[model samples]
Target: MPSPSLPPELLLLVVEAVLPPNPYQLLPASHISTRTLLALTRVSRATHAQATRLLRQRCAFVDSSRRLADLLLCMPRLVPGLPPVLSLRHLTALYIAPFGASLDDLPTAVWVRELFCEVCETLRRLVVQMPFGSLDPLDDHLSVRRTLRDGFEQLHRLEEFVCVGEYPALSVPDGHTDVWRLWPELKRLVLFGVPMDSHWLWWDIATLPRLEHVVLARPVRLDAVNIKDEYFHKLPREDVRLSRDIKVVLMDLVYDLGVVRTERWKEIDPEEKMTVEVFEVPLPFYGDETPLELVTEWARRGALDGSVWKLDATKVRQEEGSDG
Candidate 1:
């Protein structure tokens, strides 16, 4: 007697069960699911198709150089009769995390360019974690910067763009303003900082046709106090009348995980709430968390609007004669 085989749907469900929930993590060890999925692929032809589909859907687990090399190697060359094992066109989301080295290395840069070219049309979300000092305006990094900028321009279908690890508030030459205009479908943008030299970038961001949420995870400028005055004064009222939501997350200067500030612009009109809500954590929290993590937590629980929040740091500080 032969053993019974499982249905394709059930097999795919099993594959999905083992996949990592948060694929954006930087540590390779966190993606133990990668091994499990690879094992499932070897079970049979039916299992290979289902497992490979999930593997190609999100490429966030490729954290190290060796994994990246293997990903590229899996791409099949144009053969007469054989079907492609894995297709880059199937990918919809990608996370690029440059750990310690620059993405400008010869092999790595080539891989980046090729990967971008392959997924340019289909990719809808991108999260980049650049190592600090990687995007500096030095002659050595000019070519790599151009490659990255060009790659950004090619992603017409991109909806969400998140860049962590460092501030993107560079000079006009490397300004994110230039790169953002190309993404017409972009809806959510998460950045560490915003350029304070001028108001044009902020206005430009608001003007985007589909943009709705702008999260400055850790703004060096535009604190809880100054944003109420300094931020809106700069943008042209006529140009920024369009409705949009902007969130500014600031950290306490002295304490590690002290306070989280979120300012939301429900509408362009100044008469609206337009208030900054502060979250005072009474319980001890993890010190290793990033600002983006906190922002995500608030967003997940629908606490971003500050309606249920009790503490208002801006008013409390003002009453105490302390500036935010």
Candidate 2:
């Protein structure tokens, strides 16, 4: 009599048992243990398939320079009629950490373009935290620039896109137009800490046919007066062409007081057939939560289905010493 074999479905569940609760959160590479995944992949061909998929999904969290370099150096190992290694082909969502050690020596542009090329057909959500000085590598090489642009154009299926940094990710040196038109299927776009000159992004926003929500955000501080000007001035009332209503959300995070203070306004452009709504929400909490974490969570929730507006009731103030 032959020994009984465990079903593949059961094997997948066993493999998933080792995954962290929130695998997508940015965590230190050392904190993540892959010994189990490696052991399982060596167990059998069936286990290898399942473990490979899990590992590929893990690449979505590009948290450190080492992790980014690993991804850049990864090569695909395809099994007959099966998914390849480095799991780029199976990826659907990605998040780039907002803060980390400077990754200057790596070919950041090639890595980004390679990932984009493989996942362009499948990726639905992307959150890029492009910190100051991060964009220099991408703009340094001419061939790299063109290839990156081509890869960007191929992401037609992406639904939610977020860019957060001191400078706009899409800023062009020569002032190119209609760049936003590339993502015909984009539904939600979130931009934070955008520079003063990125007002051109508004023109791109108007070109997205399926765009329903646009979020512009900044941290609340003494210089927020200038921040307000930079964000508000981007909202143009003219030449807006849309068949249905779209909402533009402006948010400001007050980190010191553990509050998110927001103001919403509604602008009805009759000639342009677009309705822009600015929603005001003030949410306070007590914890070690960071501004980037809070904003990323807010943007992702709203991007999924626009249910972020339901947090309106949480706008009420909670007293400092109260235990309620």
Candidate 3:
């Protein structure tokens, strides 16, 4: 007998305890070490089944293109118009950044985008990072973002979202209704790969009363005026009452920028500057591990409240002290 000869039920509990509690981390092949994975798989059929359930619930693999294709192949028999065999209703977290830098991999990109959209209805935590070198043809870039926007538009259940991609001009045309409803359930949003011209999201993001934690990436752009808005959110004064008490986290700050330049981001709202916190990590990948850990804590648990999340997008906030 093995050690104390524990029962199967107890053994299953032990296995689960050793595993990552986050459902998305249940990937046996990836998250689990080779030896641990083998040991878990060898335990018994029931243990295997449990492991399989975890895999089905969350796919937190770093390389998404290959695994997603494999998953697509496994989804029932080449059906026509049938709802997927794996709708992933129980999925809670996902991490998908580009695996490589190649404009030719547009097909894989499309597939990954589609796959994420399909499961958006239930996912609570999501991270999508676009490769800096991936945007070549303008059409493909715009099209993918549009698809992503549409996908996000319907996600009333998502809690935490991390998007690192080309978000230069998410311009809201004057008469478009129902724009802010895109992220009603969102609590924490971490953005990387922020475009130089991307000032549009600041107003929308800060005003989201439901939002608690916001993180943004500041590329090492030091032309002073050139990177004026990097890792910055300018909350208009008039609409400040409608906003929640949000804490801002700045990841990967470009060190040489100096305190004088950094303080200028607060000109929009100096008091709002108090809400900001900076995490000093060496950039390029922000060490990769830290971001995921932060995301996990952010996405792990949060009670959603309908009343506090109320937003009246119709009444736009004109910039305070503006000459216009």
| RMSD to true structure for each model, in Å | 6.5, 7.9, 9.7
Query: Mind giving the per-residue lDDT tens digits that candidate 1 earns over 124-236?
Result: 77666655356565654546666655556678888877665455333336555657667889876665555433466555555576775555434544433344444455456
Per-candidate local distance difference test: 0.53, 0.55, 0.48
Where model 3 places Cα greater than 4 Å from the true spot, the runs are 1-5, 20-30, 33-45, 56-59, 62-64, 75-89, 136-154, 164-181, 193-199, 219-243, 257-274, 282-324
Candidate 1: C-alpha lDDT? 0.53
lDDT preference between candidates 1 and 3, better one: 1
Please give each candidate's TM-score: 0.68, 0.60, 0.61
Ranking by lDDT: 2, 1, 3
Could you give candidate 3's per-residue lDDT for residues 1-324 as a string of tens digits? 657767789877866675555333423344454236446655665566554445444444435577667655554433244323333444556655545664346556566656656666767776655453455335454455444445456566778765554322322333233333366777877665443244545556655667776655443332332222432335445665334566555444336322213334436445553355544433454455554444333322211111111221121122443321
| TM-score attained by model 3 | 0.61
Clashes in candidate 1: how many?
0
Steric overlap count per candidate: 0, 3, 0
